[model samples]
Target: MIWQLDLIILVLVIVCAIAAINVKDLLSAAILLGAYSFLLCLLWAIMGAVDVAFTEATVGAGVSTVFCVSAVFHTTRRTTD
Candidate 1:
């Protein structure tokens, strides 16, 4: 494995994780988390753990991101009636 590429991806993962936490918009945070998961999946694939990578891509990036966005979409502001 190329150490340089691994380092780059690792940096991106850290950045994404921090950005997701700090982002104010829920949708943006969800997208950042999804990107973070996908980068992790790439790292797993590069390390020859294809099965783990596939699972991360499908469940972490795919399902979880979708669930977050869906939940955000269904949220509504309350009004004092």
Candidate 2:
């Protein structure tokens, strides 16, 4: 059961990571990155690292995403590359 949950979270993390990179919209990419972080936190929790998971969930999903979105808001969403 636990292994299955871990696998699901892992898959979700991977999918979110790919989506974050492939999405054309900067805001959507940032949101997907946050979702990836949240999935990573779930994976960490299942691995028995509660403290690390909590930190990742809070900082990665919350603070980092906020900063990224704010940057996107201040600048243009289109990328040259």
Candidate 3:
């Protein structure tokens, strides 16, 4: 059961990653990136790395997502490439 949960988390993380890259909207992509980080944090927690999971959840999901959104706000939403 634990292994199944881990596998599910891993799959979710991968799906989020792919969606983040494939999405054309910058805000959506940033949000998906945050989701990916959260899934990773869950995986880390399952692996018994509490400290790392906490860091990933807080820094990756919180700080990094905020930074990315702020950056998008400061710049144009449309991408040239």
User: Runs in model 3 with CA error above 4 Å?
Assistant: none
lDDT tens per residue, model 3, 8-39: 89889899999999888888888999999999
What clash pairs does model 1 have?
A: none
Q: Which sequence of candidate numbers ranks them by TM-score, best first?
A: 3, 2, 1
| Model 2, span 1-81: residue lDDT tens | 399898878888889988899988898999999999988988888999999999998988999999999999999799743
lDDT of each: 0.89, 0.89, 0.90
lDDT of residue 23 for candidate 2: 88
Compute the lDDT for candidate 3.
0.90
Better of 2 and 3 by TM-score: 3
Candidate order, lDDT descending: 3, 2, 1
| Runs in model 2 lying further than 4 Å from the true structure | none
TM-score of 2: 0.92
Regions more than 4 Å wrong, model 1:
76-81
Model 1 weakest 10-residue run by lDDT? 72-81
Q: Model 1: per-residue lDDT, tens digit, 18-77?
A: 998887787788799999999999999988899999999999899999998888789832
